[model samples]
Target: MDRRLFIKLLSQSALVSYGLLACPYLGWAKSAFDYALEGQELIQQKNFAEAIKALKESTRIDPNSDWSYGLLGRAHLGLGQKAEAVAAFREAVRLNPLDTYSRMMIEIVTQKPLPKLEKKKKPVSPLEQEAYSEEALMKSELKAEEGLEYQVKRVVIDAGHGGFDSGAVGKSGLKEKDVTLDLSLKLHEKLKADGKVKSFLTRTGDYYVPLSDRTATANQHQADLLISVHINANENKTPHGSETYFCSEKASSSEAEKVAALENSVIKFDEPYKKKAGYIDIEEILLKFEQQLYWNESGKFATTFQERFKKWLPLKSRGVHSANFYVLRMAKMPSILLETGFISNANDEEMLKKPAFREKIVNAIARGLA
Candidate 1:
């Protein structure tokens, strides 16, 4: 038999095994499957609106198909309908917990807007109420600090990509991994010299560290903060600026989501994180609430750090945004990721290649942390 025919037969057998062929709604299942395939093809062609329509039909025909829902989310995301994308992705994950792509999509979509509201004055859930209470406590602590004393005592600096991972490369031959590592080292030295707080580095030399391990290092040291250093890149090469980011369930903007996606693309190279047992139990629920509180604090700290760093940065300040970063997710302490400059731009690349420029960046970061 031909390879295509064999594959088709195998797929049909699998569908039958799943009882898709024997169901009372077999016609609907077949229709949904056809529409889903069409939608995927359309998405590949960048015809997102048409793809969305097909995917919507697929979902309506077979609401339980997690694959169709995940495709629908991608279609919505391509059209910049973040709220719709998040909802579709959330349903996909709920129907199939092992759908890592859908889970990542939910994180990316929710990093900005904190999920969409169904109606005006929606009733708050118990989890939301607890998160709000913790947020209030955090605010009170901040308000009580009338003095200019440092809020963070110990910090772990993480250089984004290294070793075989050269990260984004510039036309001028500058590598993101090299720049981040150098910048991180300089910042660590400056912070240590200040003597106000202790400092540590996730990577002191050129090498790769898994994203999860980076946060594990911070947690092990019981650091007060984690600052991840990275360089931005763009296909258009027009965007050039420094942006600080805090981890959030929803992205604050489409641009922030794109950045998160770019950074997260590296996850394919890392080992899969083994989830702890009893993930859906009470302990996990409480841990999620605590993480939310940490995220709230991280947002505040990111804003302050951006404000101070912008004053000294020679490049444009894109300001602070929030997104779900894998490197920041597991951290117990407040964490932020900084995109120092766009390596894709010629002007920014030239500046980034200079030792003096990196030193200036280090000084700005040190002052911001202070």
Candidate 2:
């Protein structure tokens, strides 16, 4: 079956597969407000395990509150317990069908094929919980390297596509290039304000900078890291999330390939423009396989970025993925591409338009890179 059909079947099976949290233990006295407030605070601090505990307590205290379950799902997502996340999100939707966040999150998680959750829901297995719990703990206790503090002498921010390249336009005409440019400008300004870092743009105006040129500019400057920003869209408006990608020789799955195809299409300019390309030699693609070191580092930064971003925006965290992206493949240093959000999704489009939300995203990225 096609992806849409697969997703539909997945969603239907998911709803029938998972049930509400079954509790045989005595309830706690924690209030819903207490759980939500404390959970939100812990999540802000990137303490997802503790946030899950707090949210769970809230749900135990008030089983009727869908907000608690939804928040619990967010915490589990941060911890990478996709199965538990799907369960919690499903419960949230069952409790309150009107909760869009819960519904969206459920669909996203289910699409990835999470295992059939236990009916008891009492921390499925300590081993699985421990793995994600450690991740949350490590993030909370983050420490800088001995002499490798978030040091950046030079930085390059690449706005995915521009002039003559409308990029991926949604049915509503929300162009990827426009959002990427505005977001990149915001990121540039934010990075520039950091006295320790000097920022440069591959292309500041609405002009197409060949993918090769974008990476070449960063490599020439000896950039500490390069960040390419773009927006994501899909055939179905239902899928919405923020996915970060790092370069790898491993081919992407069919879904990822579709996304890459849509994004790469932006750079297909006229022949005259193609002749001036810096990355015309296909030989360079093989060199990417040898740069596994940079790919590993880029993956680290991508993970950090997605974790920080999900705290502010309610976008689903699609995790750090690897793909043979041309923009990333040619880069000499660590490079990451951020698929901000689905511009095609009405809810996300509304959120993307807000200045406050944009600033929050920019600030999160800067902090993550720092």
Candidate 3:
């Protein structure tokens, strides 16, 4: 199908998914239809440059529409336009915070390695709202002595795997991709509601992404911090607990090999044409390790996370370890991978389904980062 038609179909799909098709009061239907048609036509012609214009016009016609931004972002992504694609995806989320696809795209495209956004006091939901106690105030003052010089402005929170790629499956049938996405969304909501830190997610849907692309997203956004969340599994099932990993300047041969293997596995799915041998090489990845500054600042951030995890979470803190995971290796700033818990563990699996439990996990994460 032509780009215009494809976009039109996508817009229709988005509307249907949103259950807003029968709304007579909102003139969104006609406006969405028009934009989708023109946007798809331009996109199909490989006219991404012009497609953005038409797609944006669609959004202007219907200010509350997310379809326009989504279609426009797709066009930009196809055209190798990172900046515009980032903006478009961001707009999609702003229009509909629950639009998982948009949220994921924003996380993938705009997350940067720099620490620019600092935490600010913002409004929170009734459930999350609470005044800082005198004791808490005293502690904050004391904690400032050890506070890292950099401030957190924007954070990139990655929900590992999605859509076609379910990283691991639990006995209860909960997909790793789905669980991470759920937790990431909860974290995003908490951060936004708290009005303390701006946050972004890497994948908001059930789609597969290149591992390299995930790290690139964080670098692009210049994120103050990057937290890639995942559930752990093992053949033994005996090992069940939460573990956090930070980047290591000196990854042992075995550790580096494992990191390369895990990240490389995803590359094959994205690049099937390369020989199987292509996945075995770690030399290239090791060369890229120096890109992340490991001297002082990153270490402090990692340490802070480890300290907070023990203070808050119920799970046993496996303590922070260094690894050569592709996601952590590519971040230009402080980054960590959080293995929330072993999904394979029967006990952990049950707790994963509860909303309150998930919120508690989110709180711990926020507090850890704070």
lDDT of each: 0.81, 0.71, 0.68
**Number of colliding residue pairs in model 2:** 0
Candidate numbers sorted by TM-score from highest down = 1, 2, 3
- Which of the two, 2 or 3, has more TM-score? 2
Clashing residue pairs in all predictions, respectively, total: 9, 0, 22
Off by over 4 Å in 3: 1-150, 249-264, 271-296
- What lDDT tens digits, residue by residue, belong to model 3 across residues 1-370? 3333333333432323222322323744544556556887897666887888788777776655677787788788766676787788777766656566666566545544322334565554332222223335546876896565446778999988777778777898977888899999989999999988899878777788777778778877878788888887765566666767777656535543453355345665654334455242222332343344542456677677777866777777766666667677767667888878778788777888778878878998888877
**Which 10 consecutive residues of model 1 have the lowest summed lDDT?**
7-16
- Better candidate number, 2 or 3, judged by lDDT: 2
How many backbone clashes can be found in candidate 3?
A: 22
Q: For this target, which candidate reaches the highest lDDT against the unseen true structure?
A: 1
Please list all clashing residue pairs in model 2, or write none if there are none: none
Relative to the true structure, candidate 3 reaches a TM of 0.54
TM-score of candidate 2 on Cα atoms, chains taken together: 0.55
Query: Which runs of model 2 end up more than 4 angstroms from their true locations?
Result: 1-153, 270-290
